[model samples]
Target chain A: EDQVTQSPEALRLQEGESSSLNCSYTVSGLRGLFWYRQDPGKGPEFLFTLYSAGEEKEKERLKATLTKKESFLHITAPKPEDSATYLCAVQSGTSGTYKYIFGTGTRLKVLA
Target chain B: EAGVTQFPSHSVIEKGQTVTLRCDPISGHDNLYWYRRVMGKEIKFLLHFVKESKQDESGMPNNRFLAERTGGTYSTLKVQPAELEDSGVYFCASSQGLTNEQFFGPGTRLTVL
Candidate 1:
């Protein structure tokens, strides 16, 4: 079965602190891995999509890197506004289906 | 252009009452998807619609949840006789073809009392 697992259920970081959140997955014929950030009382905001192993993407202060079996979302000198729940999802190579299997996100808090 | 949009940003209803949620995907987007995030749980895909066609509905929790995309423009998800476990945030997303990036709307927070 295809599944996604995110570690470090919750993290409290000092402002400007750098840390990484992990997203491990078990899927057959991986198609894509996605990173999303969700704030309280809001839906998820798209961050990045990594298609193949060794692929990487970045936006502002966030970087996402993908490997054969997992992905990492590295926050560089995060600010308090960067505090949000980071989510990970994977789409398999299943034909004709666009559904995404998600992980229980990692809640991040960057205290100022 | 405006991003995806959902109706009823928040709704609190009795367990047995019915509620309808709506979503308007970005214009020209052929792919519209529905998802939900239960309390303390990850966001889950409920269904996907491709231009008024049900491409996938495998993730819908039960029969009480009904989703439809009429005229290939906007969509609606009606939960008849909602249950307590149905409390969650219903989100709508849309994407252009050949791309995996889905833009989301401010979800509908459903609370069943």
Candidate 2:
């Protein structure tokens, strides 16, 4: 069975603090790993897509790195505006109808 | 360009009532998806439509849910005789071709009394 799990269900970070959220997965075949940021009452916004192990992507204060069995979303000196639920999803399957499994997500609070 | 859009930001109905949620994907997007998140639960995939054709309905919870995308344009998810367990936020997403990046809508909050 393919499943995704995110650790540190909730995190409270002081402004300027740096931390990392983890997403571990077990899938038949890894096609893509995605990161998204979701604010209250709003849809999730795309952040990054890591396709292979050793791949990394960055945007401003956020960086995402991938490994064979897991992914990490690192926040560097996060600000209060960076507070939101971070979601991880993995697309796997050799068949044409791929399955996208999502983690429970990590709620991050960057207090100013 | 406008992002994906869903109608009726919130809906409240009694159990056994039917509700129809609509979504208009980004223009020219061929892949549309429906997802739901019940209270205290992670969002789960409901179905996927590729140009008016049901590509994957395996994630759909039950037969009481019906999804349709006509003319490869907008899509609708109708839940007939909705149950308490069906109360949740319904989200719609869209992508182009085989692209993995999917844009999502604000979502519709459904409440069953």
Candidate 3:
């Protein structure tokens, strides 16, 4: 069965602190992996997409790296505005529908 | 460009009632999708539409859920005889093509009592 698991369900960090969130997935024929940031009362905002192992993508203070079995979202010197639920999702090539399997998100709080 | 939009940000209904949610995708996006996230659970796929056709509905939970994308533009999800378990946030997303990253709309939070 295809599944996604995220660790450190919640995290608190003083502003400027750095941390990483983990997303481990088990799927048949991986097609793509995605990262999203969701604010309270709003839908998820797209961040980056990783298509293969050893791939990495970055935007401003965020960097995402992918491996065969897992992915990590590294926040560098995060600000309060960066505090949001970070979500990880995977698309299965075998599914054919291009539907996503999402992990329960990691809630991060960057206190100023 | 305008992002995806959903109607009725929140709704409260009694069990066995009917509720309909609407979504307007970004212009020209050919693929529309429905997803739901129950409290404390991951988001789950409900269905997908390519233009006005139901491309994939294998994720829909049961027959009580009906989704339609009329004219390949906006879409609606109707839940008939809702159950308490139906309470959750319903999200809509769209992309230009199958491989494009989907842009999501602010979800509709449904409450059933």
Candidate 4:
């Protein structure tokens, strides 16, 4: 069974604080790992895709790193605008179809 | 270019009623997908469409759910005799190709009494 789990279901960070959210997965075949940010009443926005272990991607104050069994989304000096639910999904399967298994997500609040 | 869009941002209906949700993907996108997120749960895929064909319906919960993309354009998801458990946020997404990133819509919130 393929499963994705994210820790720290809810986090409240003071503005300008740095923290990391974790996403762990167990899948049959590893294809890709994705990170998305979702605001209230809006669909998730794509953040980054990590394909292999040791791979890392960054955008402004956000950075994402991947490992064999997990992924980490690090926020540096996060602002209030960065507050949102961060979702993690893993695309993996032997079948030809593209299947993404998602985690429950981490709700982040950056208070000013 | 406009991103994906869904009609009727929200809907409230009684159990056993039918509801149809519509989605219009970005122009030229050949792949469309439907997903849902129940309260306190992660979003789950319901089906996928490639043009007018149903590429994958493995994730569809049951036969009461019918999805169609006539003429290879806009898509619709019809829930016949909807159940209370079916209440959730239904999201639509689209991509140009198989491996490309999918753009999502604002989603439709369905509430059942």
Q: List DockQ, one per candidate, in order.
A: 0.74, 0.76, 0.81, 0.70
Summing lDDT over every window of 10 consecutive residues in candidate 2 chain A, give the lowest-scoring window. A92-101
Docking class of 1: medium
Alpha-carbon shift of residue A99 in model 3 (angstroms): 1.9
In candidate 1, stretches whose alpha carbon ends up further than 4 angstroms from where it belongs are none
- Our tally of clashes for model 3 stands at 0
Ordering by DockQ: 3, 2, 1, 4
* Window of ten residues with lowest summed lDDT in model 4 chain A: A92-101
True contacts kept of each: 0.74, 0.67, 0.84, 0.53
lDDT of candidate model 3 versus the reference:
0.94
Identify the leading candidate in terms of lDDT. 3
Candidate with the larger DockQ of 3 and 4: 3
lDDT of 4 by residue, B4-110 (tens): 99998999999999999999999999999999999999999999899999988999999999999989899999999899999999999998976666788999999
Question: Model 3, stretches more than 4 Å misplaced?
Answer: none
Would you estimate the TM-scores of all the predictions? 0.96, 0.98, 0.97, 0.97
- Report lDDT per candidate: 0.92, 0.93, 0.94, 0.94
Best candidate, DockQ = 3
Model 1's chain A TM-score stands at 0.97
Q: Give the 10-residue window scoring lowest on summed lDDT in candidate 3 chain A.
A: A91-100
Docking class of 4: medium
* TM-score for chain B of each model, two decimals: 0.97, 0.97, 0.99, 0.99
